[model samples]
Target: MAEKPAWLKPHGRPWTRGPGRVVFENPWIEVTEFDAVAPTGRPAHYGLVGFKNHAIAVLPIHDDGCVTLVGQNRLPFADYSWEIPEGGGPLAVDPLDGARRELAEETGLEADHWREVLQAQLSNSVTDELAFGFIATGLRQAAGGHQMDATEDLAIARPPFREALRAALDGHLKDVLTLAMLLRAYHMAREGALPAALARAMLG
Candidate 1:
């Protein structure tokens, strides 16, 4: 086999940043406008939104090949969306804890096992929003029912993994985090990153 190429190192040049001013501020995000010199030495003004929290999402797969999904009205799109359990966690806190809480709050399901599956920047050019994805298995109902937020009127669904994957591929599930995580789970099943039985159940 040919030797793998060595990892590349960063160029390590910092952009020349000018003073930045806040354009808008809310509880969840802050938009700032700044002047900067780009790597190509062009003067530019940039507007970026910074999130107050990191996004967390959990994919809860039960032993029976079913996954939990939550449905709610999303304000930005003014449409109802079905997605895997997701929430925001303060940047200073552990994201895994946020995943656990969101899973319980949205679906009243608790997982006995948890694994961090993916991390990605969400729209890096527009917002400094980071996301964490987790795989949760060995699920059971919480002692009490869902503890949803006051603003949330969520509907819960438990569907076979294959059905959910189809919906995601068909664009019925538009949430970026949900799409990414579900595809990651499928990749895991195909690549043998998951247990044989569990992978079979998920892919089937």
Candidate 2:
């Protein structure tokens, strides 16, 4: 018997509803309108909806191999959640520039080295958004507090490599992006593909 190619398999649920973007304010993305048809063949109208947009996130590795985490206030949950340093605001910031800025703003550390790690798409039934993730190692302490905005009063934590991974597994680090990068960084560091500090932290 012949097996199908991995790509041939459906990766997501079949769209039962068809919602088309009715109006577009921005070319990259826009408020969308959807016509969701029911299983019984009845069609329904879905009005305006806020669309998702591209974003960049960083899992910063310090000189000692620890991953830097920021505790910040998230209005959605009305409480602070531990996530990777992230934010290009509501708009797209230059990829590298935004990654750099986020590293500094959230962690008060400047990276001497960085590289793009992964590019992923978040697909919902209605919309999909691209997210860029980066691996930042070789961190240097900043002279002043991280430049934080009103939504980002954060405190930085540098946890040991294994400790961080354990935290992530234990739900202390529940941020999806952070978990993705940590596992990626872990493999890279284990193979000595990462900078010395990162490798050391991963082994610890």
Candidate that scores best on lDDT: 1
C-alpha lDDT score of every prediction, in listed order: 0.93, 0.73
Candidate 2 lDDT, tens digit per residue, 10-43? 6544436584765766644566678876555677
Worst 10 residues of 2 by lDDT: 45-54
**lDDT per residue as tens, model 1, 1-204:** 356567754565567869999989999999999999888888999998999999999999988788999999999989999999999999999999999999999999999999999999999878999999999999998987799989999998999999999999999999999999999999998999988999999887
Off by over 4 Å in 2: 1-30, 36-53, 89-93, 142-145
User: Candidate 2: lDDT of 102?
Assistant: 76
Error of 1 at 14 (Å): 4.6
Report the lDDT of model 2 for residue 23. Answer: 77
Q: What's the lDDT for residue 119 in model 2?
A: 80
